[model samples]
Target chain A: MKYNVTITIALKEGMLNPEARAIQHALANLGFPTESLSTARLFKITLDATDAAAARETAGQMCERLLANPVIHNYTIEVE
Target chain B: MKYNVTITIALKEGMLNPEARAIQHALANLGFPTESLSTARLFKITLDATDAAAARETAGQMCERLLANPVIHNYTIEVE
Candidate 1:
């Protein structure tokens, strides 16, 4: 079967995120004051897998291996 | 109330996505062949707003004015 997967990767807490800070700064300047802001990368992949579990497992591997940096990133996976 | 909002920005159809292609190539070289792959940017913003509706409105405005290009990229907003 073909699986559509979405993986959202974000920096772990306490990590410095200059991009998010810059965005927050811009928002504040635009009158949309934000208490805090963070950024993440979301990857949508289409691939062939045997089943939902298989897709989930492969997706997890992808995150560990490439999509995310394990030391400073955490990721969530959704298979549909 | 303090609202947590997430905005996901993706390339519109027919838009050239070289980054996605490069990642897809890497994934293929890693033995996880994908039918296709795409990427998006997700912004998680925590800000003060009157209500959920107010928060949604502000987030939508943010995308229209800054977060999304509105020409080649489309964005979805989630407020929680």
Candidate 2:
């Protein structure tokens, strides 16, 4: 089966995100009042796998091995 | 009301994403064979809004004004 998987990699809570902070400040300047902001990287991958579970597993492995930094990043996987 | 809004900004189809290409090659090296990979930036924002619609509208403005490049990127907003 062909699977399309989406993975979102986010910084762990309490980790400093300079980019997100900058965005919030910029938004405030633009008249959008934001209390806070955080950011993540979303990856959409297509591959052939046996099933949805297989695809999810493969995406997790991808996250751990290459896509995300384990120490500070948390990843979520969705397979379709 | 306090709202949590997420905006996902992705490159439009046919636009080249070099980071995604690099990730695909790196994933290949790590033994996870992916047919293709694409990437996006996700922003999670917390703010005070009248309701979900207001929050969603504000997020759309943020995308248009700062978060996304309208010429090459498409953005989606989800408010909770």
Candidate 3:
């Protein structure tokens, strides 16, 4: 079977998001009132697996091994 | 009122995602069988907006003006 998996990787709390800061500054300058902004990386993977459970496990492994930096990031996996 | 808004920016179809390609290569090298891989940027914004509709509008504007490059990227907005 084939499953479509989505892994959303986000920075752990308290980690500085310089890109978000830059974007906030730009948005403020553009007259958009933004209180705070944070950013993350989302990965969509389509792979063949035995089942949804297998796909989720593989996706999680992928996140830990390559998709996300465990020290500074956390990830969530969704299978469809 | 304070609203939490998320803006997901992704490369439009036909655009090359070198980063995804690199990740895919690394995954394959690691023995993970991946059919296809894609990546996107996800922005989480907390801001003051009159309503959900207003927040969505502001988030969309942010995507258009800065968060995404219209020529090569597309974005989706969610407000909570």
* DockQ score for model 2: 0.88
Q: lDDT by residue for model 1 over B22-80, one digit each (tens)?
A: 99998888989999899999998898999999999999999998899999998999999
List the pairs of residues colliding in candidate 1. Answer: none
lDDT of 3 by residue, B38-57 (tens): 99999899999889998999
| TM-score of each model, in listed order | 0.96, 0.95, 0.95
Q: Across residues A1-80, which tens digit of lDDT does each residue of candidate 2 receive?
A: 99999999999999999988888888999999899899999999999999999999999888888889999999999998
Clashing pairs in model 2, backbone N/Cα/C closer than 3 A: none
| Stretches > 4 Å off in candidate 1 | none
* Stretches of model 2 off by over 4 angstroms after superposition: none
What range of 10 consecutive residues in model 3 chain B has the weakest lDDT sum? B58-67
| Reference contacts preserved by each model | 0.91, 0.97, 0.95
- Provide the TM-score of chain B versus the true chain B for each model in turn: 0.95, 0.94, 0.95
CA lDDT, every prediction?
A: 0.93, 0.92, 0.90
Better of 1 and 2 by lDDT: 1
Candidate 3: which stretches are off by over 4 Å? none
